[model samples]
Target: MSNHSSSTISAFGYEIIRDHILSSVLGKHENEVLYWAGKELARKFPCRTIEELVAFFVDASWGMLELIKETKDGRTFQLTNDPALMQIGYRSFRLEAGFIAEQIQQIMGYLTECYDEKREKQQLITFTVKWDVKERIQNTIPNE
Candidate 1:
């Protein structure tokens, strides 16, 4: 199969697992479990830079991730999917948020967390990744 076709099939499978299977299996703790799972995934596939992080999301078929803003303590990112793909009812973005949090923590060497805000009307998600500069970790990803 062509790469594009393979990606489409992968994305379809991802939706099935993410929207239906995971929720059914995880039940009420679905979000929490997925959040931690994302963190674990990040550790396994670490990204050293924001560019790599953005590319990782696309390569993983998660979504189109764009860094929309940055501040002293945090960064804001927007995640959007194709309009046709937005029909899926799964509203949870916790997994993506957790992944971003962990990636940022490793990259910045600070205690970091991410919160996701769903804009259903806009069919997009906004992630606010915040870090405490004071809470630095010793082993950080070196800049490339």
Candidate 2:
């Protein structure tokens, strides 16, 4: 028999699965779980630079990722919908937040953290990622 199970799904099917996971399986824990899932996804697809990371977002259907600001210790990224983000609320973007945090942390060799700011009216999400320079040279991961 053919592998029908591996067939491509329509956008409707995609939304159905997303909604189910958000409203049923994940529910209140949706933010936390999805964030960690994003981090794990980053590990699977590590990017060496900010440009590659932004491109990865576009390729992954997460919308357009743009670097809006950069500072000594960190940067701010704005994720705006190229078309639309399906109106999934701010919590949905935590996944992207976590993904970005891990990617930057890995690139900069620092312990990083990220949080998102929602602009519901504009359908934009901003992620502020920051890391301390002191933490970079510290004993973060110990020998096992």
Candidate 3:
């Protein structure tokens, strides 16, 4: 998971570890743990802008992340992976959601959260990210 790691893993290999191995080890707490892990990852590899965030997703082999909509209080993103990856059984996107939430929270100085909805027919996931504009965090992480 290191940003500077020279090694690369195939999509199938990534799925094996992420979907099979982690699921077996974490069981019912898989989603929750992955979410926090993703947040920690964001802290380690911070993205200063939406462009950098999208690039990070691609580099991490998470998916192609696109900002579909934006509002004063929130934003909506669409994530799509390789069609072959979609056929590889069940998958959860909570990690990606948490990553986006934490990144936005750090960038905006707000308490942000994100949730994802699977668009099965479209073979994509939609992430809705929201923040309390009225309740700002006292200490926001500065971009490095």
Candidate 4:
């Protein structure tokens, strides 16, 4: 095996690589691409319950995920962690926002959207994921 495969990267190391790619490689389109990438990831790792989705975030080392509030239309999630070694910004969480949006869209069978707000002082990020009940996802294939 290659030395790269033999060595394990720490969470911080992973964050650094992620940040570099988002900022340097993706550049201006980082947020947009990351959001789509996250949606694609959600498609791959579909969750049946909110608990499973939350657990996935922790396992992925994204941060501590918590459901702060929920309404008939949507839910809000709070993700917080120390600012040491990670870039706290809008782009940083777009992937997560998209992931949550897609997961909810699939589970609720509605058109969902997600946006995030960053509290720099608190080192906290809040994602508001919502969908209009009236805008349901149409089934493309008929049940056979």
Whose TM-score is higher: candidate 2's or candidate 4's? 4
> What are the per-residue Cα lDDT tens digits for candidate 4 across 1-144?
567535644756776678765579889888898899998888888876789889888767677889999999999999875565336763378889999998888878889999988888778898999898999887511233
**Tens digit of per-residue lDDT, candidate 3, span 1-144:** 576667665777877887889889989998898889888888898888999999999888777999999999999999988975653247878788889999999888899999988888889999999999998987687555
Better of 3 and 4 by lDDT: 3
Q: How does each model score on lDDT? A: 0.84, 0.79, 0.86, 0.80
Largest lDDT belongs to which candidate? 3
Query: Model 1: per-residue lDDT, tens digit, 1-144?
Result: 567636454556666777788889999998899889988889888998999999998887777999999999999999998755544356578889999999999988899999998888888889999999999977766433
- Model 4's alpha-carbon lDDT is 0.80
TM-scores of the candidates in the order shown:
0.87, 0.81, 0.89, 0.84
Ranking by TM-score: 3, 1, 4, 2
Best by TM-score: 3
**Candidate 4 local lDDT, residue 135:** 94
Pairs of colliding residues, candidate 2: none
Q: What's the TM for model 3? A: 0.89
